[model samples]
Target: MPEETQAEQVEPQPQEPETAPEADGRTDPWSDPEAARREIEKLRREAAGHRTKVRELEPLAAKAKELEDAQKSEAERLTEQLAAERERAAAATRSAVAAKVEALAAKTFADPEDAAGALDLTAYVDESGVIDRDRIQADLAALLERKPHWGRPDDGPRRPAPDRTQGSSGNGNRTPSDPANDFANWFKHSLDQAR
Candidate 1:
């Protein structure tokens, strides 16, 4: 083994040129600064055109959103109105049923209160708000037949005739002296005798 001098160690070496590898045997456009700048400028122009299109459509998009909101609000208001109308109709139906029941009860029973208490409104009234009069009458008849006491006159007992002798003038079987005083005396006499 021999030691080599520094001049012999420093032998000239062959150099290769620096170059980018070609993809599919074609040059990349990005390798040229001018081509890259042109590509960037083209992209910027396309972007500007897109921005202009978006700006042009903005008002139409806003109008469409506003219209949709207005329609939704109107639909909500109509729904509320319909609900209110249905409530009013239901209340009116109930009122009509009540009036009919009260009238029928008054007609059927000696004491209207007794009839009102005994009657079932639900049984007579249909879902469509129609009342069954025949059913109501039949029910009333059945009730009256079952409870005979309910049909009796409420005005308790009758009073006996007054005795004329107690309030009459001195003559044993006398007529009043004046015709005008006769009616007045008879009325007074009847009231006093009854008491």
Candidate 2:
């Protein structure tokens, strides 16, 4: 409850100045404009060296781009060449298939009479040897125009029909033609359902 002394209430003050280190009368190196100019000059020299390096590498960068472009062009050329080769191979395969078809047709129509009277021979055959519907139709038209009398069903001319008589199995005795013989070896409709 006694009164507080003024000296006890007062705080101690620091001896250091509130400003920078220049209070000691010594100049800071960064404060000199001429020294700062020298530092800036050094930085500019380093930047100039970097600029020189960039200038020197410019041709290399351009060459790398050129190489990349060349590689791309070569890849495109190879892709085109591969596609063309595949097309050629496909064409060759088609040609081989056509040849095989021609061989089969020749085997089917061995006789001239069979070629003329049986199925017109040209109805399902084409010049390309393939059984294309449009090509076969054209060939059939040509054959009909060439042989008008051959396709005439109304012509009463007695042409000898081919010997389609079925032989007996094991019996040596020959029997007469059966009344139902016409339906025995009839051509099925399943043979004409192709596209």
Candidate 3:
């Protein structure tokens, strides 16, 4: 065996491990489950308290808003009313145009709804809200020309009303619709019943 040198023969001395920096004395939630649970509970309580506060303040906030609206200037109130009236007027104009379109389209188109939907109608109403009937007619003509099938056909689905279907099975009791036949059927049925 080779002679052991003094350097090699010295045993390894165990040194103390370096201490980690201080952790602000707080428990690591991952390491302490109870601490994590307590923290969650505290947060929940705080959230509940905030919610209760909000509930108490809601009525006051609504009253404040109501007061603010009530204190508005007469001009501001009139402006609001004017805006609402203008909206209604626009809606009425559109409705009037739609009704006219529906009635007119029904004359040429098999499905008035389809024709009404297909037409670009915004231009039919002028800035003054007067409907331009001439423009609407022109547009309808152009649409019918572009899509010929949208127009009603002379021989399409307008067949004569179907006769009410009579039961064809030759077996069931036939109730006579005519009063003269009813008396004859009653006698015949009574005889058959006796048999």
- In model 1, which regions exceed 4 Å deviation? 1-32, 108-129, 135-195
lDDT of 2 by residue, 106-149 (tens): 43333324223433333454565455545534554465566655
TM-score of each: 0.51, 0.38, 0.48
Per-residue lDDT for 1-195 in model 3, tens only?
A: 122254246455544444454589654553344444467667767988999999999999999988887777666989999999989987888788888888888888888877778876677998877888888888888899999999988765777876544565475665437887888999999999999
Q: Which prediction has more favorable TM-score, 1 or 3?
A: 1
What's the number of clashes in each of the models? 0, 0, 0
Candidate 3: residue 130 lDDT (0-100): 84
**Lowest lDDT block of 10, candidate 1:** 1-10
lDDT for 128 (candidate 2): 54
Question: Worst lDDT window (10 residues) for model 2?
Answer: 1-10
The predictions' CA RMSDs to the true structure, in order, are 16.0, 22.2, 21.6
Overall lDDT per candidate, in order of appearance = 0.72, 0.56, 0.76
Model 2 segments beyond 4 Å from truth?
1-39, 106-195
Measured with C-alpha atoms, the lDDT of residue 102 in candidate 1 is 60
lDDT, candidate 1, at 58: 100
lDDT by residue for model 1 (1-195), tens: 122244245444433343466878755546555454567668867988999999999999999999999999999999999999999987786666656656776755677657656777667778777888888778777888888777746666889888665685766686547877888999999999999
Ranking by lDDT: 3, 1, 2
